[model samples]
Target: MDNRFEVAVSAGTMRSDSSAAVRFPHRWTPGGVTVEADFTGAHLLHLAAAGCVLNDIYREAESLGIDVSGVRVTAAGGFDTTTWQSTGIDYSVEVSSDASADKLAHLLEVVDQVAEIPQAIRAGASVRRASSC
Candidate 1:
């Protein structure tokens, strides 16, 4: 995993109150969410995965009767300079919750298996320029 391509998203109690970054409304939290990633393709790609994981953490927490106060997800990977293809991605999860450690672990595991963006990237997708009017 390369720190050069890392992107992070934080929401709820995990979010920075002083960050100048504009916060986006998150369904799972009252204070919303903040993104710490650039607009580059690689940064955005990792941002998407980090954002999804952050969102699903809160979403699944509710369904499982766990109380999650905050979530921060970081994702990063390298790319082959020649072809610009991805080298692979790695992510880490930091959570704020009163739930038991085992419960928190279960929530993370479920989110990883179900988060749409990571799942899509893991399964792989074809990118093609679509013909448009």
Candidate 2:
């Protein structure tokens, strides 16, 4: 199996020489948090993975009668300074839950299994444009 997939993206704005108008599936505003990222271009990929994992955890926790109000997933990636190549990503998953230790661990395992974006990234799958006009 190739283990690869591709997708096409079309934007309404024309190619800009200096600036570009990017779009994201969801928009979030940080009221007082220091971390604020405008999901555009490559940043969207990171957001997708983090969001998927977070959603999975939240839903699973809810099913187990655990509240996930203050849960946060801090996803960070490192790039090689010389080559400017992406090295790897670190996931800092923090949650305030009342579930048992084993239940929480099980929930995390399920999160790993159901989160599609993170699974693709973990498998080292390449993302590229299928076609462009």
Candidate 3:
């Protein structure tokens, strides 16, 4: 079976309080952010990726002097039911900005490269519980 999950994270103008997802305070956007995802490991994994991309967009935009008004990131992936291992995660982005199309594109590219969570996922790590625990 495909244990797939999808999640979306939105900030600024893209934020929607209509869903049952939790809203968290954001440093970049005035209205904070909304995380639309269920409480599950698969959903949380996707949410981590999507939320990181959204945060990085705002951060890089400020560093580059891009006037971004909003950002939305949607991430999806599946786990192998047999091994309970991730199949990998994919994400998409939407941004509201007055910057030129090229600038926007470049900003996205930069964020894609620099988002810590995505990079960490790519690099891979060993996850294990403590012996004491």
Candidate 4:
């Protein structure tokens, strides 16, 4: 197996009798988690990073024989409007596990080096518009 996958999401605005809101549909997740339509582009970017890290923590922990009970990752950053580019991102990970501190730390360190989303961002992936409708 290639061990690689792609995800697609669609975003748009919806209007009801009371107000208009943004909607983002993530098809890859169970029930397709949706958030309030008020988030900025930067917020979504950071959210993807956080989600990837959290997922990877559990994956790596299981592979390393560490029993993880919980995991949380927070990713936050802002973009410069003038440049329309991300300024920087900061993330913190917290995990509840039965493993020793040293083992947990080692697992996190390995995940930090391998998590896909952050690595792609750090490597400066190119973005090009595919179509307009």
TM-score of every candidate: 0.92, 0.60, 0.95, 0.70
Question: Which residue pairs show collisions in model 2?
Answer: none
RMSD to true structure for each model, in Å: 2.0, 11.0, 1.1, 10.6
When 1 and 4 are scored with TM-score, the better candidate is: 1
TM-score-based ranking, best first? 3, 1, 4, 2
lDDT of 2 by residue, 1-133 (tens): 1111111121112111223433333222122112233554345555566667666776677676765444456666655555645566556566665677777788888887878888787788766999999
Better of 1 and 3 by TM-score: 3
For residue 60, what is the lDDT in candidate 3? 94
Give the least accurate 10-residue stretch of model 2, judged by summed lDDT: 1-10
Encode model 3's per-residue lDDT on 91-130: one tens digit a residue: 9999999999999999999998999999999999999887
Per-model C-alpha lDDT, please? Answer: 0.87, 0.54, 0.90, 0.62
- Name the runs in model 3 displaced over 4 angstroms: 131-133
What is the lDDT for 131 in model 4? 100
Q: Name the candidate that leads on lDDT.
A: 3
- Model 1 lDDT per residue over 35-125, tens place: 8877889888998898888988888999999988888888998887667788888899999998999999999899989999999999999
**Candidate 4: count of backbone clashes, pairs at least 3 residues apart or interchain:** 0
Question: Candidate 1, which segments miss by more than 4 Å at Cα?
Answer: 1-3, 18-20
